[model samples]
Target: MNIRKVLTAVLPVALLCLAATARAATIGVILPESYPSADQAKELQLGMTLALKTWPGDAAPKLVIKDSGCDARKADAISQEFIKAKVDVVLGNWCEINAGADALRAAGIPFISSNAERVKAQDLQLQMGRIELNAGEKIAADLRRQTGLRISARTSCWMDFDAALSERVDAVLCPVLTMDRGRWDQVANTYGAAFRKPFTASSARGYAAMEVALNYLRRAKAMKPAAALKETQATATLLGPVPAADAPAPTTALQLVFAPHLPKLNAQQTQTLDKLVKTKGCACPGGTLRNGCPRDSGPWGELPFVVRGGGTPAACAKAINILEL
Candidate 1:
């Protein structure tokens, strides 16, 4: 065997492989430091890392993580750092992404947000990509047009009963988190094992953002990164299939009814409740008010509320309004 010749040939190939690995796409992730709690930020980071590990690729992209502290100035600084690093893509929560959006757009680096909040008009003009769970604004607009339900307040908190079920409001529009129970349980178990804590919606969101970034990179090999991202079809992610650019956003937001708001009914009132539940369908899967809400111990559980489902938000609003009246 020619040992010298073998070493010469193998060393070059090894160096080339290293070079290829080094050239893999760099992904920048900005997470909150103060507003949402440091533990949540850590969970988001862990979710991103897990996504990279599970990604079906020989060379995983590198990650450059920064803490925005939910501060605009800090977020802007982090964006500058990402720009200097020449990251192929960026992902972050709403605060950080919105604060640094202008700089990132100017840099021509594609960025995506996992925020479920309604996107601002300016952000839309900037062409910021978002994978959000809440479409409360859209739903509100739709309900307003269809049912003439007066919306008094909008909140992101799922358990904001005070605001959501206020006496002045006809209906509360809020985003709901939906996932395949089996798939979610599997992810939760794995995540809990790795982090020794319960998996959260934030964790799922972080994972989804990374998946989208990697997908964009994959498509960027053939076309422009922005176009690639824009063209990305619905992806079957941990949270579920993210809707394509033009596809109707998933049904995530629901109209909630404050159970306590309904006056104590006589036989006729009870009959009306039964008829409403039968025709409109109960928001609480536990059946109707007659059966009682089985799972009401969480946030809104403090006040006892029912979700209005199985019909349009406007219809739900009308029914609840009639019941209250």
Candidate 2:
């Protein structure tokens, strides 16, 4: 073992280590584990991991996953860890996003949400899945065709699967991710094999969101939060185009329409609803009534309203109206 032999081997090992470190990047993921629907968090992470496998390099982006528990406090704590480690990007479920959005924003970290309704355009908050929020009109139209009802005003059904509610309402619209039929079937098979359980729709969004995030990472010159956000919004994903940065929030309201005889609200309930409507003022876009449940009240009649099940049409049909607020 002479000095010359030792130097040659040490130099090669050092060069390899340097190259590996230079090419590697870190991505922080916040998922809700040990909380409601913990399995969803696991499934989502699996999807993200599977997508990362397709990255075009040997030096894959290193992932640091933290359990957010769907709580603001937990999410913030996990985000602090991400900040300390200087992660290149952060992605999470909507609950995690809602919990940690403020902290991540203040830290200048871009947060991509896999499932959530877009609340106005925030600089660091990017919504990725099923961004459309208002499906009231579409639900009503669907109801009309199915029940042959002259229904106009849209009422929200808390429990969409109830057969009784379905019989009464012209249609009950539930907000859900519309999966790509072909890819979903494939993913389902993969997920079943990987998890030893059935695949959920939320799992699909998790997979899609990660795929989109990776695409953005690949295209960006510098993986800074602002640059990533700009590039992602400007481009389209395999699923489709991301929403325009300047586009107004989605107006898709889920609704359950009733037949000709609208359900009547009790005196106290009616008063409460009326007050709620007054408080949520603008039933139209750009209105002053900030607290009111905005309603089309016009031919569209596609306002956002909620209906609860009861003994009869009166109890079952009663609804309270409001917007994202």
- Output the number of the lDDT-best candidate: 1
**Residue-level lDDT tens digits of model 1 in 148-247:** 4454325434321223466666556554555667777887787888778778876776776787778778887888766676665445666666544433
Model 1 lDDT at residue 54: 79
Q: Which 10 consecutive positions of candidate 2 have the poorest summed lDDT?
A: 155-164
lDDT of each: 0.59, 0.55
Strongest candidate by TM-score:
1
All models, RMSD in angstroms: 9.1, 10.4
User: In candidate 2, which residue ranges exceed 4 Å CA deviation?
Assistant: 1-21, 56-58, 129-173, 193-196, 221-224, 234-240, 249-325
- Badly placed stretches (over 4 Å) of model 1 are 1-22, 95-97, 118-172, 246-252, 257-325
